[model samples]
Target: MAVNTSGRTTAVDRAYSALLAEIQTGALPAGAVLAEVEQSARLGISRTPLREALVRLAAEGFVVQQSPRVTVVAGIDEKDIRSLFELRRGLEELAVRAAAERGDAAVFTALAESFSAAATANPGLADPAAHAGYYALISAYDAAVGDAIRNDYLASALRTVHTHLVRVRQLAKDNPERLVVSAGEHALIAGAIAEGDAALAAHATHVHLHNALISILSSIAGSSQTSTEGTP
Candidate 1:
């Protein structure tokens, strides 16, 4: 229900960001109804702007329009995860390879060091503050890679995939061990890019993504089992 009163962004943009954040954080969980009038009133925005935001989310696959008036957050399952990663692996590998060929070595070297530190720190999964810092480091790494590639088209495509990825990441909230391993893998990828070794960077990216997909799927399965067992 936080409404943006700042004139910096359009009403539609503000509504979209607020709703997207809620969806990503699982506040507006999968299958949650996004009634136009209700959300518009809650967000203190007009129905027109809210509909604009919903249309944008629908295009990004974050929401589905069941009818002209009914919209809901999209559901993500194991199959959706696999499909997302399949696209991610291809795009990210290409991005890193290009970055290796064109990026500033110093930038990637610095990212490599940061990722190494994250691996060593081994932040606890239950600690929200620690996990936020860890995710910030990953975001920095992502920005570095995106800047290195210098391709708006590729970056735009990757951004779309990452939008869905934010929701998927919630499934791995309890897997601190996986985060530690992922940090190491990122360091390897950054190190390879810093050395301007295109082939190595691409290969490292592939391996990292392969391991990440496995870990994520395993985490999702474990969470599902736990929830089922706890159900009366």
Candidate 2:
């Protein structure tokens, strides 16, 4: 959690991003205690900025204050997954539809081509570098869609959703098959938007989300079963 003072971002922003990355990558697992004094020292920032970062994470539901002073990373369960996807489906559908209607066709077409390439690459989930590259493509696609929408309120809401989504994503990171399938799904959505087929884009987004939720839930169940079997 070493701070980079030379960077343009504020200390609070740096601390938040560092802590958030740790939480998402499971370096700080759910229920991991975050002692203010210790964390502030570890992040190489003062308590005031650290508290600001914690407050932001708490507001996003990534961490919860257990008492006046204690905070811990929040847990994710099947219910949380389902609830997340439910909100995601609605918001993403709206975003895709708006993008289809308002976005530059060439931009989405380029994204579709990129997604197709990612699918062909078929990077194994175990390779962190390759997987990160694939995720970067997805992030680019998301940014394109977000930019096209031009709705500040909707964009803000989606940002919050994505914050928690980063953590949930780890549950299915081992499933390369899902990654391939998701690539295809994103391609379809991007293609539909490129063609200005709002209805098709929305429908494709819905289908993609449904599949994603299933994959994540299945991965969670499998992991839980494995843990249970090993416990005895």
Candidate 3:
């Protein structure tokens, strides 16, 4: 739900969004320590609300609280990434199909605008900063499609995917070409939706996600090989 005209978003909500944004954007990278006292001081909120926000984040898999002094940003391991992408692929396929079948011109326009923003943010290859902006653009695209679909279950599924998308976005940034491919895929998906080709849109989204997974896995494999080669 969109926030009201009132500028005051709740403290806990604000804190949660802020922390999640930091973690999602890699500003608070994986395995980084999180001190509630420091965060409360930085955000100008009380420990009570910060704790509440942390609890919510933890429940959502952003942070893990192994112990009081050992809470850290959760890392998306290979298995986790694969699982999240699998779920995302399924849900996004459904969302794209619905959007294609039922979404209006405005929805298509919104998706096109988001793709333009992402392309502008990542002209060729995506660096860390460029990728962060691209992720924001993709989130907007997802939100636009979710709203166009107007299904509560689809929206819920997209929410889960978005959480893991933050991490996947970071990993993909390591391979700049993937950004170009992603932008192209978004354009194709948007075009399909605009034409009301539900089947085409769903198929395009699935292919896009599968290509992304392959690229990321390839990058990871190469990194491992390099590390092994360098070992004493």
Candidate 4:
């Protein structure tokens, strides 16, 4: 059944979307407790709808039930990150190959040009405004891939995976250098797709994923080491 805006169901959707965004963006950090009453008050929803939203998040693994009354945000560690990338490399490689074979050359060519421009602009994403443009370009390219692949199941699965990826991306420390390299990698993928070369696009996607996983892992490791050294 579809929910309209006038019912309690809408409240559940509202609460769910708000909480999900906070968790994905790290505003609600892992292990942060979700007290039902407090959340209801904060989100301006009734307790019943907040509870429904909490249940939805728990079912999706965004939160964990710690006790009869305690619910907390879930954490992503190194092992989880490795597992995530392993699945990503598989799904995304297949997706790019499909996209390369089926995508409109004009669409991909424009995306490629946009990515090239982004690289030249060298936004580095150091400022909040710069971050928006950089991420918007990446989102546009991913949306193009989803449309090109034309697989509902794969697209749905990838959406679920990407929700987790937003959190994983936050774990990495800011590195303007990496963002430039990433833009180039994206250009290669878009270019290969524009050329209608499935094998080449798949190869480029694989290389991109391999490098991205390495970079994110390295960033996490560096952060951990620095934290450990600073602790008594």
Off by over 4 Å in 1: 1-7, 122-129, 225-232
Which residue pairs in model 4 clash with each other? none
**Candidate 1: C-alpha lDDT:** 0.83
In model 1, residue pairs whose N, Cα or C atoms come closer than 3 Å (at least 3 residues apart or on different chains), thus clashing, are none
Give the root-mean-square deviation of each candidate in angstroms: 4.8, 5.0, 6.0, 4.6
- The whole-model lDDT of each prediction reads 0.83, 0.82, 0.75, 0.81
Q: TM-score each candidate.
A: 0.88, 0.87, 0.74, 0.86
Error of 2 at 64 (Å): 1.4
Candidate 2 lDDT score at position 111: 95
Locate the minimum summed-lDDT window of 10 residues in model 3. 223-232
Better of 1 and 2 by TM-score: 1
Q: Per lDDT, what order, best first?
A: 1, 2, 4, 3
Model 4, 1-232: lDDT tens digits are: 3345564558888898999989977789889999999999999978998988888788878999888878999878899888988998889988999998989989999998887776678334434456567788888998999999999999987888887888888778766666767778899889999998989888888888888888888888887522210000
